[model samples]
Target: MNRDIAIMVDLQKLWDRKVEFEDGISHHEKSIAFWEKKISDIRKDVSVLKENLTQAELEIRLKEKKVYELEEKLGKLQKRRDVIKTEKELAALENEIKAVETEKDEIETVVIEEMESAAGIKKSIEKKENELAEAEPKMHEDIAYLRSKIENYAKEVRELISQFNAGLSKLSPEIKSRFEKTIKSKEGKAIAPLEGETCGVCHTSIPVHIVLEASSGIKAMNCTNCGRFIYKKENV
Candidate 1:
């Protein structure tokens, strides 16, 4: 019974180490994912800013063309006014010139606004690009360090599994099955030490006879309340 208890204890200890290492690896993986997401989002934002600048430049060109066409029409009307035969024709030509000039003025205003917007967009793109450049190296370094830690954890877990398997081989089939079931139900704790008259894990009082039997270490004893195998810590 004592040998079985020893086997279970050693197995549990090894399993606990495996869990610890695996949890560490999981934590580092999450950190790496977070950094990757940040980099991707920054790149996407930079792309959007660049697209906005391109669109603004195209709009500016179209507005400039409209202004040039309106100005050309105004110039032709002004030249026609010199040959006008009546006051009405002269007035009509004046109206046409004024209309064209007004339209050109509005288009020029839009062009100026678009140019300013393009400048702002360009500046924002530059700032975002710089930020991405600075962050990429640091993020990559951190990811590499995290990956190294995961690799080390994986190596240690493999070693622990080998030790656990060696310990497992010493246990009887009946005891091994019982231990597996207990660990599954009890969150990896298949055995609990006796604490005074109670089970250390569940803090439930044990029968006097059962506590005495467990203390003798004559056989492995189960706690009545929690069904965990009981061991005497001092005897061990």
Candidate 2:
């Protein structure tokens, strides 16, 4: 294990932390989107309720008009009751009047039922409206907070990346390129650390001959078990 490799592993750790912060920011954005979509869906539901109420009212009005026309026909038929008409004709008119009255009654019942249903729909719409009114501002606030967090996290990542790159520039090009390649290939993981006398990334034990060479920190060493470079850490 070499000191330069250790430093590369430390840089990878910083990169990992940077990714974690970025992921947190992404999570906040997704949360904001979820709430926003919920609010939108609720509003659509409220709009549908309103349309339902309007249609229900229209149906009630149509039924009421039918009842009114039936009553007018019944009155006309009753007026002809006293007219000198044939017995059969008067009977027919009476029957017609009765039928109209029955239909009018049925229409009135339907109108009443429709009106009740409309009232229920109106109540639902009102409740939904209140819910939307309360939710809209809160959703907006949540989105704003999420956006702010994302922006702050982005700024912090930029600063960290600048510092990381500045540190990387101090190393040789070959070592830096190798570290970058390994970091990318390992998904931001450290290439090496001591894991119970073996390389954490490579799972290889250090031979006594190479152990001193690695511990001396003169050059980077590759693990025999896995090809990942090994680095020595003083604290560990």
Candidate 2 lDDT for residue 188:
69
Best by TM-score: 1
For candidate 1, give the lDDT of residue 186: 32
Q: List the residue pairs that clash in candidate 2.
A: none
Candidate 2 overall lDDT versus native: 0.79
What is the overall TM-score of model 1 with all chains considered together? 0.87
The 10-residue segment with the lowest total lDDT in model 1:
179-188
Task: At residue 195, give the lDDT of candidate 2.
Answer: 62
C-alpha positional error of residue 160 in candidate 1 after TM-score superposition, expressed in Å: 0.9
Q: lDDT score, residue 34, model 1?
A: 99
Model 1, which residues run further than 4 Å from truth? Answer: 181-186, 194-212, 223-226
User: Clash number for every model?
Assistant: 0, 0
* Tens digits of lDDT, candidate 2, 22-83: 89888998898899889989889999998998899889888888888888888888888888
Error of 1 at 133 (Å): 1.3
